[model samples]
Target: MGTNTILDMRGYRRPEPGTQPAYLFPPYKSTLRRAPTKPLVLLPHTLSEVTGPVFGHDAISPGDDDLTHANGGEAIGPRIIVSGRVLEEDGRPVPNALVEVWQANAGGRYRHRNCQPHSPLDPNFNGYGRVMTNSEGRYRFQSIKPGPYPWGNHSNAWRPSHIHFSLFGPAFVSRLVTQMYFEGDPLLPFDPIYNSIPDENARKLLISSFDWETTVPDHANGYHFDIVLRGRNETPMENKR
Candidate 1:
């Protein structure tokens, strides 16, 4: 019988400890330069109405037949009316705010690059639409339920059913890019886009609630997603205006 003994080698280094490395590393300093602080400048501008003629060659035609054909087609799934009010943080109506939305077709296919092949693309589904808010800062769109599509990552890889929203506020200072998702989607936790917003409250703001009341005459399902844009708060002195 033979027994093997192991030796304890605790501290062993090839070169040496505390060896200074030679490199040109800049001194660490705060990159933020202090500016001459002044009172915040507030600009005044009227909200633009989303109705009537607007410049932008890409605006979709608001033809009733377009909506009808989109709803009646087999590839076009459930018809829904997405309506909401665009308001300021103070709850004031943001008239004339441009709200553009793009989403996957009812079959859960998008008009983008690197899409899956198994999912059938809707021939009628342009997968794009836009709307402008009314006088009361309200906007509406006729669309269908977007199907959840699988990504190449895993068998369960699916994005939460969502619609991309782009808002151009009254002033150039008021622009925002965001997306709306359906509430209670199982894929929310796994979807990268849905998880992009770190703030829970901010994330919740993007999910629309199913509103049966907002359904159109023949439509059974509808969703309401109100968006709030940043704006100047009215001061007490401004009440005189």
Candidate 2:
């Protein structure tokens, strides 16, 4: 049986009529109505431009520092550096793109509903952060290595280590909602979210490579994950459909 069918049979709530499936619809709609036909412009390669700083400021970079949110309590874990480029399908840089990342804290926990009850919540680990691509379409953040947590799937099942990524292209039509996975994560093969991508090439695109250079002192490890936003395609009059 299909995964959804099994879940539904197990009493998982189904959407009401006229409502979209929770996992099927995007959170927001694009305002753009027309697709551009010109050749896609790739973003620049050199990092430049000072977009505003991101959240988790105190926790950024590797360190033994504590993560205390506005609420209270300390977040524990190893520091990690997450960096990547925003590019177009043609491998061109896409500057000014907005990249947002949200993830669980070190103890394999999150501030969300499914998190463990005993895990001390870190007020600082709000799990939400945003950054803009520089002139070279680059972005970076320092965070703790998120631990895999269990769900209802099996006796010992666990979600993979992942970071949620939201990207807004220069044009409204270029928006994308995706997640980045760490290389060699054991849960990748079993995670329902990761298996949702039908295409292997597309699936691999979400897994980031480890980059030692980006690992700043106090950071646990470094990851460089790039994303390519689809851009307008150029076509001659005769080639227009």
User: C-alpha displacement of 119 in model 1, angstroms?
Assistant: 0.4
State each model's CA lDDT, in order: 0.65, 0.64
Note each model's CA RMSD in angstroms. Answer: 21.7, 15.1
Q: For residues 1-241, what per-residue lDDT tens digits would candidate 1 score against the true structure? A: 2222111111111112222111221121111243324664443332332112443523545642123254445446887778889997668898777777788887788877778675887777766677778789998887777878877544567877888888877555457678889989888887765654556676788899998878767654779999987655344233123
For all candidates, what are the clash counts? Answer: 3, 16
TM-score of 2: 0.66
Model 2 lDDT tens row, 121-194: 66667777777777898988767778787665556667898888888775544567888899999889987667
Regions of model 2 farther than 4 Å from truth: 1-74, 113-118, 153-155, 236-241
Choose the strongest candidate by lDDT. 1
Question: The CA-based lDDT of model 2 is what?
Answer: 0.64
